[model samples]
Target: MVFGANSIAFFMFAGVVARLLIMWPIGETSLKTWLFVHVFRPLFGSLNGSLLFALSFLVLSYIFMYWLYRKRIFWKV
Candidate 1:
């Protein structure tokens, strides 16, 4: 479980860096729009123009972890 969580965190951090690289060069307005369309619309139906993909990913990951814990299933080594 610990190792799984660590790997998840590491990959998530790397994803954040990648998102920044993609979003930053295009400017804030474009980034915000892209995030809303790509990340928010798919999951929630409503647009989340304010939150970026990294932040949304973190929130979703936490929710998923909680669900997994409730089910008493952890990734085995």
Candidate 2:
């Protein structure tokens, strides 16, 4: 079934909350390290790659969730 706008909004809200919970334990420096080791260092090879990777992932995740929302694939619960 197709979801209403409010449903999609709530799904986005839940996603943000879940993301925060997941990141809370990782901490800032570790997060940067993780990003650098797995993603940034290989692709961009810049000291600032972690920051760029984080920003890009943020934008990409939003776009991905929006695409899923358009497909009526987001969780309702």
Candidate 3:
């Protein structure tokens, strides 16, 4: 039972990471528009209208989820 629950959580995390990767390489403008304006802008100093090889959502999501995984964090309903 414990193994099953762990496996489900593992796969759920994998799926979320995969979805993020598939939707990556988002435009700078799109990020600015969709995400919070003050969040990353202050932290990263903006994308400067970069297009090619820009900061991707996939990379960010993987970093975030990997950190959570390392911390043994999980969300339950």
Candidate 4:
């Protein structure tokens, strides 16, 4: 179920909530803009740009998955 959360309905929920909670306050001019920009821009503020910040997080998730696999670990529940 690792990828189950990314189905269309889930993204719709996330999109709406992200627009309200994040994009609204950050002075984003439009919801047509990417949602991750609002959610990640602050934490990644010093990363120079969204692409680098996103790539860094992607790498981090992959490393974490590999580490877990090496330990024969996976999530349950």
The lDDT for every candidate, in the order shown, is: 0.59, 0.62, 0.51, 0.50
Query: Against the true structure, what is each candidate's TM-score?
Result: 0.38, 0.38, 0.33, 0.37
For candidate 3, write residues 31-68 as lDDT tens digits: 33434344555555556423312445445545665666
Give candidate 4's error at residue 5 in angstroms: 14
Q: Give the Cα RMSD of candidate 3.
A: 9.4
lDDT of 4 at 28: 43
lDDT of 4 by residue, 5-58 (tens): 333433444456545644454354644244456555655664555676557555
Best candidate according to lDDT: 2
Ranking by TM-score: 2, 1, 4, 3
lDDT per residue for candidate 2 within 1-77, as digits (tens), equals 22353465546755775466456545554554566677787887776786687677667656666677777665545
Candidate with better TM-score, 1 vs 4: 1
| lDDT string, candidate 1, 1-77, tens digits | 53365455446655775567466644545565576667677776663433545576567666666666667656544
Which whole-number lDDT from 0 to 100 does residue 72 have in model 1?
66
Among residues 3 or more apart in sequence or in different chains, the pairs in candidate 3 whose N, CA or C atoms overlap within 3 Å are none
Candidate 2 ranges with C-alpha deviation above 4 Å: 1-47
